[model samples]
Target: MALTLYQEASCGLIAGAAEAYFSFPFVSACLPRVDPTTLSVVLRAKYRNIFDALYSMSANKKISALWTNAGPYVKTRMGTNVGMLTSYNPSLCYLRDSCGLSETRAQLGASAVSAFFGAACSVPVKNVLAQGKSGSSLDCALKILKSRGPLAFFSGFSRQFALVGPPIMILWFAYENVRKL
Candidate 1:
């Protein structure tokens, strides 16, 4: 039962949505929380104190959670879709043609490579999400680079790679196997 291009695209969309839905809460939880009171006071006399009012709103926590996680969620979802679309066929072809690997082996290799690239690309977005600022991702990346050095962008790469890689590989392997069946 080979999947058509449309079916593959639909699967990618489903996977992206599921990944965003499931991972967002964990991502939100990891974000640094701003102390509402402290933030309010600091912004009280600055620029008409809009920050204070915004941070002090009754729905502050929910709003902050959404704000902090939304960008990363979108980034991650898009990255997932792109990674799957870009890597799947290429990896399969490369592994099969260049390496003379079996279909299963090619799939596993492709999945592993895709997971690695996905995790690598997500480092900056993860950092920005962890900081939970309303600023742009570019600004956050620049701030980390300036304050913590160029390598700061990949600060938690090892840990995140360890956490994310195996599951992705497993999921891809399982999906390919199931599809074969």
Candidate 2:
């Protein structure tokens, strides 16, 4: 069963929210810190480490979840939908036309491609948040590239892809099932 556009968007939004909420901490930890002093302070702080880490790892999140979490999550979710569609369309075309796959197989293959693209696109956004930078995403991206090198964008990619892929695949699977109903 094919999902209507609204249903597909809803599924993507829900999945993105869940992914962002659950993965934020781990994603933050994986980013490279510009200030080594911050890491040391957090480590040596013992019981205060959590607070220290949170403060350093995010944009003064102690202030408000809306600024620190929800806002970014929504932005990330919207970005993800764009990334998915960008990748999915091309992958679907390749799978169907080049590989001569059936419609179902093509969709599944395209979805897998979309998941990888979405996860890859998310890395820089996560890096920006982890660094507690309030700049535009482009500015943050350039900062990462300038300060940490091109690889900085992919700092936690392996871990992130491992964590992100399943949920994406599951979301698509569930979306398909729901559309059938």
Candidate 3:
């Protein structure tokens, strides 16, 4: 009935990849509208809404433009899911068995650890994605590196992680507890 770490990681990776791919269209449409730096791009382009953004992008550019940074998006998603999923069981076991924590406390601890790593893994990519940079993911990456160096990716990590960490912790905590039932 239990899944091994390999199985868990594989499941997480596949799920993350699929989620990113399927959601990229919506994400691509929304990011420019919300990201202040890119909001002007949306406004000047006169995209009224998500549909307008999608329509304009597909009409003016290749349909593939809709998934401009999908590679990095999917990579980040996989890292986050793998961080959460792969760490869950081992961390849970360590907390409960080695650390002598109660079921509830151990579950909470494990979930916290998982969320921390998941957010850590995704923060850099989120920064890159938020920039709404044009080009393939790799090109965007190289541009950032050329302009700002490698550490540029982690630029707003602390603030971003603070915002995202709690929600992800709550998510894993709820999922773990609910799975028990």
Candidate 4:
């Protein structure tokens, strides 16, 4: 489970930041505004924030596919996503448990993938919501939750204790700091 606030802040910050950088409105004009009522709402919000951070960080464009499997190295990239994150951080957990790696090595490997996913997740939500979806949307959100193998959405996440957690502590600090300043 993710820290609810980080999930909220991560999504909101990324979306707002991405829009600020790209100068494109990534929100749905007629999508009933945004109401953070459920998990989907939270994720939708996260997508928006991540997008902004991706743009704000000025990260490379090549990793764009990792956001949604649109790149040439998508499989490997996604595999890295699943491989590194599924167990624990790609570095610490994988090496210690899966590959018998040392602490340093596993952390390094996981850090790399974390950077990629962090960047990708930080991407601005380019997919605008339709007034009513011109076509049947694939419910990618649901798909993200349904899979069991390879692209297993967010399942088998025995180790996903904090999907996007620590950043939240930073958020609370920042919130306090900003308000004071």
How many collisions per candidate? 0, 0, 0, 18
- Scored against the true structure, residue 123 in model 3 reaches a CA lDDT of 74
Q: Which candidate would rank higher by lDDT, 1 or 3?
A: 3
Poorest 10 consecutive residues by lDDT, candidate 3? 35-44
Model 1 earns a TM-score of: 0.60
TM for every model, in the order presented, reads 0.60, 0.56, 0.66, 0.25
Candidate 4 C-alpha lDDT tens digits along 55-77 = 53334645432243222123222
In model 4, the runs with Cα more than 4 Å from the true position are: 1-91, 124-181
lDDT tens per residue, model 3, 115-152: 77777767767766656457666777777888999888
lDDT of 1 by residue, 23-106 (tens): 665554444445666753232223234344344442436754444535557665655565565566667779989999998899
lDDT of each candidate versus the true structure: 0.67, 0.67, 0.78, 0.38
What are the RMSDs of all candidates, in order? 9.4, 7.4, 5.1, 16.1
Give residue 180's error in model 3 in angstroms.
Answer: 3.6
How far in Å is the alpha carbon of 35 misplaced in model 1? 8.3
Any runs in candidate 2 off by more than 4 Å, and if so which? 1-69, 134-139, 177-181
Clashing pairs in 2: none
Say what the RMSD of model 3 is. Answer: 5.1
Clashing pairs in 3: none
RMSD of 1: 9.4
Choose the strongest candidate by lDDT.
3
